[model samples]
Target: MIRFICCLILLSISTLVSAEEKLLHADFRHRPPEMIVENNRAAGPLKDVLDEAADVIGYKIEWRIAPFARSLKGLKNGKVDLVPRVIKTSQREKFIDFLGPIGHRQKDIVFLVRKGKEKTINDYHDLYKFEIGIKRDTAYFTKFDADQALHKILLLDDRNMSSMFAAHRFDVMVVLDKDSIESAFKQKDFTDYAYADYKHKQNIGIFYGLSKLSANTKVNAELSRILLDMSQSGRVAQIYQNYKLEAPLRLF
Candidate 1:
């Protein structure tokens, strides 16, 4: 009779623990094949990675959608718990605990222009000839970022940046990478854009960031350890492959 009572108590404790699994509020802007905010739920391979990691860590995610700037700001201010992709910068490092942790990847920063207009940008100085579209608060190449003379149109998110570029609202647009440009517009819209002949070389690093102020920030090491294992084991690549994509190649 005592043994039966102990088993029941154990089962009750297990049920309570299971019922109290933590929920994380992860936010993303709508960038397809990476993260797609659909039906107010996060659906994409990036989300899949977080899903797998969260499951292992005894947590669930409450996906949220906001503009890129808002999402970044939220990540700092505690409205957000996890952000799947964040460009790591010295300033950002102060407020964000980049986990998995702080992996760096190398990618080309491309300047895109309207189709048939590729040759217009043959040199660095030529870029000054037109208005440019760039994401707000995003770091591009060093000089391009620091230059004060460039006529840059600040955009909030990929879709808006894309729509403005597609509409010819700007003469030249610098993209985050190949995917941002490729997925910016429909396939039929391809004829409207082309990479400029001129190129500037720089590599960007991205990370899974946890707000320093979030209550869940305590799990930083556990989540980082889990994700680092996933990254090293080729599981990260597999997650991207499931969506017919390739994982961002890591530099370190």
Candidate 2:
């Protein structure tokens, strides 16, 4: 009877351990100052927020690096449980449930033009006169995306975009704020690019999305609570500061 009781206790302990081990799969594409994966480990301000939230919620994260389209498809197919950074859209909402802004309060989509040309692009209409470079599979803003009149050159990534812009292949490259443009130019040793502030005016929130197919209301609630706490406590700002980025605007 003593041996039987011992066996039952061990079984209970094993079951509890197994139950507590929840494995989550997250997919992302390379986007600097936000999400960057090196040798299978994710880094950057956005990633840091996700890591802290996962730790608080007690989940083992399995990170996968893929193109933006592939990652979005994985989420819809239930192959990926999470995507660290995504701009909320109606089409995407059909496949995923968005959580928090995750990193900062707002993010901007700006036009990166050669320094001397900044004065030429005073409005969206002014952009029509220039050849614009856009990252493949990225959504800037609804109007910009729908504008068929603007000649757009689609590039594979930021590095390519910057290189082509330097080569005079494009007159303007649509880019995220400093995090992306600064990193891309620094990588290519191109320093003559400047933001055309008057041309693009879209400032939107970024979010972490959970796959609708793999929905877990309990986990979502817990993650939201933890992220909110982190934002309020300045933990989120601290992460950005570590990267030498200005503290993100706070909506909370």
Candidate 3:
């Protein structure tokens, strides 16, 4: 009887372990007000939304911090299942299946310059004369990328680029939006920088990229449904409000 009971207990434990949902892995950078990582945990409006969606979909997320390029490589190599904040591109579509516009609002790629230099960058053409700092391997806009005459200083990431811009190493730095500028300023404890709005504005949609090889279609479908429901039920908007961010345009 003792032997039979032990076998039964062992079988139950194995069944429980097998019944647990598969763990999903994702990568992120320290993009604040959208995605922020501190003490090895991710937070922010988008992160909160993702957490809620995962709960509803019955899965676990394992977030890893890595550079954007390395994260992209991980997705291609099937080592990472998802990237929480990615802008879709024709090239990226080959390996990544975008889930949804997880961000609450559209992001505008604008120029961040010292307060007194705003007038100098009135248009895209004016940017040609200044030394501009940009994040390496990031897309600002089609026009900005196609312009070969503009002088650009490519930096590794936002934090590094912001530090260089604060030190006045470059005349201007291109950032995602006003929130990005504010986040950078808060991180560096400097608020003298201002954003320049030009004619060429890129309204980028941020999404969660699921690796085509590793992501299960059925699980992704369920996650998509949960996200859509959250958006419709105003949960997504409430999450953004909690973080003091403007809610994304409703697309129900």
Q: Which candidate leads the pack in lDDT?
A: 1
Q: Residues 159-180, candidate 1, lDDT per residue (tens digit)? A: 7777887777997888765775
Model 1 misplaced stretches (Cα beyond 4 Å): 1-19, 38-40, 101-105, 187-190, 250-252
- Candidate-wise lDDT, in order: 0.80, 0.77, 0.77
Q: Each prediction's TM-score against the native? A: 0.82, 0.79, 0.84
Q: 1-252 in candidate 2: lDDT tens per residue? A: 999999999999999999998777888766775677678776788777887798888887777787777877877887888887787888778888888865444456777887887777777788888888997767778888888998999887766777788899978888754676578778777789787857555556667888888745457778877877887789988988999977667765
- Please give the distance, in angstroms, between residue 112's alpha carbon in candidate 2 and its true position after superposition: 2.1
Order candidates by TM-score, high to low: 3, 1, 2
Model 1 Cα shift for residue 179 (angstroms) = 3.0
How much is the lDDT of residue 99 in candidate 3? 78
lDDT of 2 at 164: 85
Provide the global lDDT of candidate 2 against the true structure: 0.77
Which of the two candidates, 1 or 2, achieves a greater lDDT against the reference? 1
Candidate 3 C-alpha RMSD relative to the actual structure: 2.9
The true-versus-predicted C-alpha distance at residue 227 of model 1, in Å, is 0.7
Higher-scoring candidate on TM-score, 1 or 2:
1
Q: Which ten residues in a row have the lowest lDDT in candidate 2?
A: 101-110
lDDT of 1: 0.80
